[model samples]
Every structure is written in C-alpha cells, then in structure tokens.
Target: MNAKTTKTAENVTRCLKCRRVLRNASPDGYGPKCRKKVRAAARAEVVAQYKPHQVAKAQELLEQGGLIPLRANRVFLAVSSDGSATYKTHRAACTCPAGIKGLHPCKHRIAAHILLAA
Candidate 1:
C-alpha cells in the first residue's frame, strides 16, 4: 500500500512523526514513541517554568486529589495528605509560607495552576 493510504483494519492512520502505521487512534497523529516525546517536551516546559519543589508539590496534590475549591472566585484550597489546607488565589498568590515570603511561587499555587490547567 502507498504511504498515504490508511491501514485496512478500521482504516487506521499513520503516525505523523515516524510515518509508521498507528495501531490506535491518536488525536495528534502521533504513535507511542512520538507521543512520549511530545509529552516529555510538554512536561519539560512546565518544569522549566516552575521550581522543583513547586512541581513536586503540584504532582503530589494531583496524585492525592487534594485541590479543593473555596467560596471565592479563582480561590482554592490545597489540602495535604495530613489534612492541612493552604489557601491559593489565582489572581494574587497563595497563603503558604513560601508565598508569604515572596521568595518563590508556593506549592499551593503550583497545585492550583495544575488543577486549573487540567
């Protein structure tokens, strides 16, 4: 079959990057290898924009489903596994110690960003 032609089984398409026959449908036309590269690039971008600690905290919150919405708009509470709540304001900043010190964006802020992006 020609390179441009789809596979017979369910008319499966090819990967855009490697031009290999795709076994499954991918919205971006990327097969497993290319998809992994794309995901890794996206993750690297996020890591570059945030501190390591903030990223770790955001990941933890996501894993634990710890982000909670508060009464106010653009406001949220990031609850830790230990049941501690850290206030985060999208427009302003978080109330965590790191946020209060203004040294860096806190984990609560990172978690809020991650949750909102999701």
Candidate 2:
C-alpha cells in the first residue's frame, strides 16, 4: 500500500501531455517540450484557417511591429493599412471597418491570433 501511494504521487508529477516526469509541474500541466509543440500546432492551425494573403498580411504586420498587445495579452492595438490609425483587435473581433462589417477574422484579428499563438 505504501509503494502504491508513492507510485500515485509520482504519476501526479508527470506531464499531462507527454507523461514525462517534471521537477516542477507547470500550471497548465504540460512540460516545456509539449508546451512548445502545442504552441506550434496552434500557430499552424491559425495559419491554415486564414487565406494566404491574410496570413501574409499578418506576418508583415508582425515583422513591421504593427501589433501591440494590451490587457495582459487579451487585446491588441493594430496599425491601420493606411498607417494613419490604430484599431482595437482581439482574437474574435476587431474595431476596424472590415471587422465591423462582419468580415470575420480580419487582418488585425489574424495578427492578434498569431501573436497569441506565439
């Protein structure tokens, strides 16, 4: 019974994703390698869901430092295409005209999503 209790405690210290033993368990339960893989998968999924042009735009925005995260990374301030304005951007919504018109997943939102995936 004592040995079984020790085994159970050992299992509790293993990673949720890979079952690898960790010296310190993370709050999300994934080990470092698994967390990285998960993030990469999320990024790939977001890229696949968007059009090539939209993904390109989002990448360009990131390269040009056009998106600024806010509210503990929950929101973003994205630069306008005209370079004269900024919009409040979220993963599901954006304050840009295209987003307001119900063009879901606008460039700003895509950029924000990419940031989150990263």
Each prediction's TM-score against the native? 0.51, 0.63
Indicate the worst ten consecutive residues by lDDT in candidate 1.
65-74
lDDT at residue 62 of model 2 (Cα atoms): 62
- For residue 105, model 1's alpha carbon misses the true position, in angstroms, by 0.8
Each candidate: how many clashes? Answer: 0, 0
lDDT of 1 at 11: 72
Candidate 1 on 30-79: residue-level lDDT in tens? 57775565345436665578877768866666445455556432567666
TM-score quality measure for candidate 1: 0.51
lDDT of 2 by residue, 1-118 (tens): 6875564433456654445788786665556876676457446976898888888878677656577656776788889987999999998999899999975678888877876765
Off by over 4 Å in 2: 1-43
